[model samples]
Target: MHYAFDADQETFRRELATFAQKVLAPHYQPDDRAGRMRPELPREMASMGLTGLRVPERFGGQEADAVTTGLAAEEVSRADINACYILLVAALNADILVGNASEEQLARWLPPIADGSALSALVLTEPEHGSDAANLSLRAQPDGAGWRLTGEKTSISMGMLADTGIVFARTGGSGARGVSAFYVDLHDDRISRTALDDHGGRAIGRASLHFDSVPVGRDELIGQEGAGFVSVMQGFDYSRAVIGLMCVGIAEAALDDALDYARTREAFGGPIGRNQGVAFPLVEQATRLAGARHICYEALWRKDQGLDHTVAANMAKWFAPKTAGEVVHQALLTFGHAGWGSDSPQGQRLRDVMAFEIADGTAQVAKLVVARHLLGRKFAP
Candidate 1:
């Protein structure tokens, strides 16, 4: 099977890598320190069409395929991990809106996101329901022709700053079947936000959203009343693979630094890389990350070809970030105390990669999915 990128994809990769280094890398640390996204970043990314890579052409987007979108995710995260979340969260939410929203709803919301006039975030995980999203307690009660939503969602990326967001709330009975999705304006008076000072990926700004009496009309409800869980859960299969690529990018960056240091730094009249002890672990990590990258792209390619990719996606999700964390740790140790300093991005890379281990789904949860898919759910965990 062909493994290399096509000519156009290669060109896209080179250009995006240059853009990330020249633009994103410079502001990454400052923005992280400030715990906020740069005000101009969203519009800048939109100008590059990065924000709407997966959005449809009718909505002013390039309508990139899943493989291309995954490639862009890897390059972007390689330069600045936190900024990658903007693309990830937006693309997932855009897909949801495209797939489920009515024609008028898509017309209204898609343009703003496509043109970079607005930023979007997904509101799913609540304090009480991290992995148990199907049982989220957020309440949306019918009020005449609309619904009034009231609940708190925590650990949401870009929750405090998104101009718009998609929220899942309970509208029927209990569990997954009762959940429904709503499109809401973050600026509504009934909505209040509090940003969290996370250890890493601070620019993405995880936050808690308290929605009290937020009014949404019937038009705001996406798809049928209880189909929202299925809609969003389907998106996760794609997102998990993309997240794997993102982590691989971070790990590659860290390993590159360590390799550079090993080749140049001398100890006892020789370069440290000359020692197998210093070099073998790096070799192992390189091998692991390469496999992870292949699986991630393979999963995306399968998705583009309308093939079943659940097993590949979950495998990548389970392995990539875990490998990334291990590689980054080794890289830090290879730096020989230089990596421990706050001045070194290696530490930040470590903290950032740690989030992916739990973000989209934990390794345990991902394994469970793979297990269930391989064996029938009746016999699987």
Candidate 2:
């Protein structure tokens, strides 16, 4: 049971952190204020080989393992939480393309995705259904050897400006087995998007995507008909673990800020950190963050090893964001009055961490996944 990153992984982490500090940190404030990514950011990420970490190297991706991917996500989050969305969405879409796309399709999409010439999103959640994904009501009907889709997907990361996306829709019967995935171009006139006023991760632009009879060619279909749900759910097992790492990274950043305050800020006579009261909460949060980080990497390691890590993945997802929120809150309080100001990024960091509590899967939904695995599906809520 190794607990540390390999020499290679650690080297990569340092490199990515340096890259993020130089590229992502400078734009964080302006992008957050604008509620969308800077136009040049994606191209920058691609030039650095940061966009398609999971795609095969032959197609220009790093072909990274789960652990490497998690490391990259953590380093990126530490710079700007919103920028991490670019990596996460790209990973999800890459999983779909790698597992189900035709060789020709892979050749066409992988390079642009790897190079950041194309921005992408994984579109699954709709206005009516989120965790209950099996029952999504998006309709994908037959149209002369192709498909025409019409539905509304809300709160989608990068929806307001993605160049492409992998959209899930119902094609056969009802429930999970009926779902199919398609690669769709976001520029189509039939597709319209509206940005949502979200509390955090504003630069990512959570938006509602309206597909009005959007045409999808037969070549765009991913995997066999009625098999899309299986592919996507499998991909989640990989992503949920990485999400845990991303949350931990943001919390760690907040902790770093608090530590600086504790050591330098004066109270009574000496630094406030000299007192137990100001330092204990930070200590507790630090401990929790360490544990969460270990769990996140453990799950990711299992993924790289091709082990069945379902329980570990769910446990990481269920606990990491919840802990991150608590830890960031403690950091905010430690900052005293300074943290409350809109000028300080602490408040924004807290809001951004809160989004993860509901993003991939809510804490309760993650618990249900774990329960169903351990106690059997019949006994799960």
Candidate 3:
């Protein structure tokens, strides 16, 4: 397997990094402090053909593969983790809708998504079901000519701001096989949203959605009925890789900031970095960051090549976010009081990376996936 990126991918990465540095990094601090979404950023991303990285060129996307998408995500996230979150949701939503939506549905949804005129949110996790998404309790009952949905979804990223939502609800009897995916317009009269007052990741605008008998037509069904759970799971198989890469980017940023501070910050007649206590943790951060990057890249590579990467993806998802959290914490500690200051970049980095541990999938859930894969059904509970 080729471990190195091709020239085109490298060029794409460099361009993305340059764009982030110029456009995102400068505004991230101010926008985040105000808890505001960068409205102009999405338009810029679409103009650069980033919103639809994985969608077919016919659908106005670049049609890049998994590895390219992961690389782009890493660079975008390194600049502003919140933007990366938005990009991932857009890319993953496009991937799912394009892969599963009917021709008419695609005609209706894909162009808007590709052009960045609209944003989509994945509503899989319910108020009760998170990692256990298959156990969804949201009910979608058959109505006169369509269906009516009633449920509450919590912690939905971009939910408050999205124009459309890919919602999963139960249509059949019970269990995962009964669940169906529907593309519901968020503007419907029966739907309402409340933004969560979260401590971290506030820039991404996580929210709870309340759907009270929201009407949906047959065209809203993505793929087949009872296949929503599997479709979402398949989507996660790739999205989690992107999430892992995001963690890597956050950690890389933290490490870079810490190393820069170490070189300039003086203590005991010299830079504190001269002392092993401060230097050693930085060393460990570098080592872990390298490992997480390798795992994430390898997982993405395997995906692009059509290889089975459930195990590698889960391992990366589990390890990368946890490693990023550790590295960011270490970076904060390296700065001492400066890191604790609200105005400090390291302080913001710490909060941003903390969200990675929970987004997409929590660290605990990722470990369980890895354990289940390695041990089969014999794995302990």
- Model 1, span 1-381: residue lDDT tens: 888888988999899999998999888778877778898888878877888887899988879888988999899988998888888887888888888998888989888887788889889999999888899999998999989999999998888789998899999999999999999898998999998878788888788999998999998999999998998988899989999989999899999999999999999999999999999999999998999999999999999999999899999999999999999999999999788998888988999999999998899989989989878798664
Deviation (Å) of 109 in candidate 2? 1.5
lDDT of 2 by residue, 268-292 (tens): 9999999999899999999999999
lDDT of candidate 3 over 1-381, digit per residue (tens)? 456889999999998999989988886678778887877777888876778887788877898999998988889878888887767988888888877888778878878777888888898888889988888899998998778999899899887788898999999987889999999899887898998877667777799999999989888999999999888878887888888898888778888888998999998899988999999989988998899988887888888888988878888888888888899899888888998988877777778777877888887888888888778857835
Model 3: lowest-lDDT 10 consecutive positions: 372-381
Q: Model 1 Cα displacement at 259 (Å)?
A: 0.9
Comparing 1 with 3 on lDDT, the higher-scoring candidate is 1
Show the colliding residue pairs in model 1.
none
Quick one: ranking by lDDT, best first? 1, 2, 3
Which run of 10 residues does model 2 get worst, by summed lDDT? 43-52
- lDDT of every model, 2 decimals: 0.90, 0.89, 0.85
TM-scores of the candidates in the order shown: 0.98, 0.98, 0.97
**In the order shown, what is each candidate's alpha-carbon RMSD?**
1.0, 1.1, 1.3
- What local lDDT does model 2 show for residue 69? 91
Q: After superposition, how far is residue 304 of candidate 2 from its true place, in Å?
A: 0.6
